[model samples]
Target: MLYKKKYSSWLHRINPALKLVLLMGGIIAVLFIHNVNVMIPLVAALAGMLLIGSGQPIGRVLLFMLPFLFVFVSTGSSMILFGKGETLWWQWGPAVISRESFYRGVHIGLRALSFGLIGLLFALTTRPVLLFYSLMQQFRLPPRYAYGFMASLRLLPLILEEFKTLQKAYKVRGVDSVKGWKGWWQKLRLYAIPLLAQSIRRAQRIAVAMEARRFNKSIQRTYYYRPGFSSEDGLMVICWVGIFAGAWIVGVQWPLFEITDVRFNE
Candidate 1:
């Protein structure tokens, strides 16, 4: 559902090259800012951009965020539980946890969330074909590789459909009840044989079609669509710069969200 809506929409109005630049700038800004309060503004800005650019519902946004939140929370908590620190908040003999460690974990989790949200905003709004063209034109990426990337993206849906049909056929042929870890391994190997064969066959057909069209011998090509930077792109760059500046000033000057430790002997 999300995939269909994303492609059929008018989000292609935004320039793919500009979007790549903005994502790079945002990532650089994220590297310096550690405080949740500082990060909140950045996330909010990206949220507004995604909402306006993609016209996706809040429900969709929340659904997209769910998996990333789970990943960060699980990984971050484990790190805190095993970390060593002086201000022990929880302890079971040598197995100790501290406030410092807990807060560090929280920081890591929120940072991950912020990065994930920003990236998702970009992915949801930008068409993969446009992204490929932008890379080829603006980033000077090799055209052959760009075309290959686009082909892979285009093939994914069809490939998944084929796999689904293959799975159904396998189930009907008395290959049922693959339940646990060992079952998963058995299923993968069983599926792998047919999948690999189908993939090779598909590749051969595609190569032949490309070769018949003289695809490789062509040095110059024409694009149906050309991407251009707009005023909105400038605004986005400025916003990213401002966030980094504010974060640096606030963090260095007043310490708005400081986490530090003091040692003592009693």
Candidate 2:
């Protein structure tokens, strides 16, 4: 929301096809890079893009990434407590935990966090309409599907707003009134019913609108917004290739994360 005018962001100015390619390449790199050190540069590249390309403030990027960071740490630590391997580092009677598992956990958690940030970067920099257009052009997606995708995109923010209002209303009405399991059940019911009803109503309206526009009447349509491929698009493809190449070289060749064998046996 704090992003600069759409066109002003560096990411916005770059070709959408390139951004999408870069994000995909980043995802693969994160998957293979077992060490955070190896990931740090890649993450930095994405962060820099978010800051300079998106014209988004640094604070916004940090705030967006905070929740994923918390999840990564919590989940990684929890995995270490339950996992077993050759490099056993700790034990609590029945459970045997290993150092190898600890590092593995770290890898998994950091990768998840990196993925979350990359997704946020993509969403922040890309306009829904532009993305739809690119998908249609590059992938040859059907117009009906593209329009349906756009329709859903249009309502996503509104649905989120509605949910927030419901959450606030529950707080005001004292969701704790019922207490314990019953109270929790009441909260779920209160939130679920209205949300489901609203979703159904919204879907029906969208279906009606599509029919009115004769969206399904033909497989072809005129494009008001056409995207042209250029040298910039080529550059984006190169960027994607570089990401995969860099991560592969670092992960397989140098081995930043070392695993010490610790087989547990009395």
Candidate 3:
């Protein structure tokens, strides 16, 4: 299962549709509100949500965040160094630092962190099958499209297993002469051809089976599992909206972190 089924947290019980909405909404809000002060708190709230939803230890969560943190800081630093603004804090050759640029960089970094946390929260809490079911049932997604997408996600582990089996077979045959980047590319080509063939065969078989079952004969279909909205989903939506509104208000109140249109003015 993609989601941890062992936890009975409120987040785990919320509807997958609502979780998706929250994820998209948070990202959209972050994109519009470019202020570190506001984004920092939003990031913290998302982290807290993830912790509560996943019921994972802080260390584990932080470990998962390390990679995202690296990406966030690297991109933010680039923006700080290269972004244009007035009131230069420092200048050396091709590098320049300005107060507005620094703030913008921090804003972007916090936005990255916030987005990561929100995305992780959804991924860690919601099962892929549940998401597909929710989309089809709640959002009126076409069953063919939803099932196709879900099948792709379910195929990922099978593909990995097939790759591993191929590697073991190669080892048993004593054909393990590949090394380095070029060798890796060669190995990838070898693997890709077989994998593609296998995938095509599997897809053909699936299509035949689905056709035999008359899956495409009708646009309407019955679902074995139907996800429904609950009171918890409503509460979660309210909380998400309130938090976003509060963050925006706080951002507007903080004059130091306000977004300045330096490029247009100067």
Candidate with top lDDT is 3
lDDT order of candidates, top first: 3, 2, 1
Ranking by TM-score: 3, 1, 2
Put down candidate 1 lDDT per residue, 21-46, tens digits, no spaces: 87777787677665655554556555
Any runs in candidate 3 off by more than 4 Å, and if so which? 172-181, 217-220, 254-265
Q: Clash number for every model?
A: 0, 6, 0
**Please, what is the TM-score per model?**
0.81, 0.75, 0.88
Better of 2 and 3 by TM-score: 3
Clash pairs for candidate 2: 9-53, 10-53, 11-53, 86-262, 86-263, 87-262
What range of 10 consecutive residues in model 3 has the weakest lDDT sum? 255-264
lDDT of 3 by residue, 52-84 (tens): 667766677677888888978987898788887
Which model is ahead, 1 or 3, in terms of lDDT?
A: 3
Task: Compute the lDDT for candidate 3.
Answer: 0.77
The alpha-carbon deviation from the true structure for residue 22 of candidate 2, after best TM-score superposition, in angstroms, is 4.4
* RMSD of every prediction: 3.9, 4.4, 2.5
Indicate the TM-score of model 1: 0.81
Question: In lDDT terms, how accurate is model 1?
Answer: 0.68
Best by TM-score: 3
